[model samples]
Target: MNVNPVELHEVSFAYNGTEVLRQVTLTVRPGEFLAVIGPNGGGKTTLLKIILGLLRPSEGTVTVLGTDPVSARAQIGYVPQRSAHERDFPISVWDTVLMGRLGRRAFRLSYHSDDEDAAREALRAVEMLDYQDRQIGRLSEGQRQRVFVARALAGRPRLLLMDEPTASVDVVMQAGIYQLLQKIKQDLTIVLVTHDIGVIASYVDKIACLGGEMFYHDSKEIGQKDLEKMYDCPVELIAHGVPHRVVREHRHD
Candidate 1:
């Protein structure tokens, strides 16, 4: 039997005296593409940070790859919500991706040929090899996002975590990014956090609707009531072709 790539049991978190997550339990099986959708400040980013071991839960147990998140962090690739550095900084796409290999090194002496090979392979996987020499700032938002994915893939991780990857990209480019993720998910487990409910349903295998609590389903067939409960308001799901979008009904009180 295959072990799950991520498992959370009764996980809860708090800041100061306020609670953020409450009794959240989730399991991500190997090679599964799971999307965590929720409103802003709904603990989606917190959950990803917990899985990355950047923050510890206030309560419950978290296991990643059958080990503690911190212990297994090196085996996990992460694409955060935003890049730390300036986007317009003059940096080659290849160099940016090569940085992913830094975690595998003990010192920053120099990159080896193997590192270059891995970076190139990751770029090719994302169809960004031709842009390797291009300055990252010169590319469109979608292209930059793909380069970020390539950077994460350069680590050769078994699990990939992306936080709002397409937030900065155009709507037209979003589909392509999800398609790329679908292709890559065949080889690794993926956990993506996004608010774009419409485009995700067609790409991900499962959905975990998170607010302060979480409702997980094996498929994207979530009920309207459940969505209302998750968002704490009346919600409607609009279906267009293969994608579905969620719209919360406005109430003037």
Candidate 2:
């Protein structure tokens, strides 16, 4: 039997007595692209933080790779969604990609041949290898997102966690980023927290619709009914392929 890469047992959390996650139990198979979709303040980010050891569960245990997140920190890579538009932070695309290998690189300081090879491969995977010398600030929103992904890829992660990677980019760039995610998903177990349910239908393996309650549903057969229950509004189904999505008055909730 294949062991689950992530296991959350009876996990519960809260901030100042308001419950965030209650008795939340979940498991992720190795190399599964599980997207966590939910409304605001629904504990989506909290769940990722718990899995990453950034937040401790108030009621249960989380085992990542058979160990606590703190102990297995190096096994997972995270690409957080944040704008790189701040001024005066000097970082190159090459350096940003290199940062992902820092855990192992910390011991070596000098990157070995294999490290360079992996970085190059990851950059190539994201189609940004040629722009290695460009300053991160100089790149467009899409390019910067790819660079961040390249950084996460450098970690050689068994599992990758991302949050709203396309939120900062435009509509055209969002599609490109989703396609890039599709390619990368084949290599690692990906857990993405996103609000765009439409863009997700083609790439992600499964949809975990989080609402007033947490619901993990199949990506296939996601019709108007499934969406209405999740969003509590009328919706229309739009099919592209395996990842079908809903078109509602309010799509993102």
Candidate 3:
């Protein structure tokens, strides 16, 4: 039997009575690398916020790991959108990564060998172990993002949620982050929200696209007509072994 790591039932949220999510019903399975793709202002960030327990749904229920997300918040490792954070903060990479140790520190009054080991291992996983001693302020955008990921990994979370993981990184570094994420997926389940259709056809196990409502496709490769119904717009295919769709913006006549 397959167990869902996250489940949302008739979930609705609003700001001042303006509905942002219209009863979104979704399920995310364990060990699945799922991508939630949608245009801006389509409640992509809002939905992630709801899942992270930052905001409670105005209506309906959200269960994460068989419990409310707010109750199980510590079990999740989150990497927010790059723009969501202020990279100018004066903090050393080692101290930043060690913050993930706070959760484990409660058991002991001091930092134990295991906590340090985990932090070092997390940095190693992202290949940023050498930069651990440097200040995050001096690092490049890509390197800084890698450190942020290391902070989350030190928690040894069961589920990792990232909103726009490659947002601020350069094109070349964006590909690098994608490869790094694939390496981490072996131990933890990853759920990322992205609009870049270029790599979804290759990296993701499944694509759950959200627009007006939601469309969950078990197969990344499907019939053209089905995709048309999902996007409700004309989609052009750029055939090059990996199927690519050139989604054009629609104009109001």
Per-candidate local distance difference test: 0.87, 0.79, 0.78
lDDT for model 1 comes to: 0.87
Q: Write the per-residue lDDT of candidate 2 for residues 179-253, one digit (tens) a residue.
A: 998887775888888766666666677778665356666554454554666666544444466543445454545
Tens digits of lDDT, candidate 1, 144-170: 999999999999999999999989788
Stronger candidate by TM-score (1 vs 2):
1
Q: Estimate each model's TM-score.
A: 0.92, 0.87, 0.86
Q: After superposition, how far is residue 200 of candidate 1 from its true place, in Å?
A: 0.5
RMSD of each: 2.5, 3.2, 3.2
Q: Which 10-residue span in candidate 1 carries the lowest summed lDDT? A: 238-247
lDDT string, candidate 3, 176-207, tens digits: 88789889888577888876556555676777
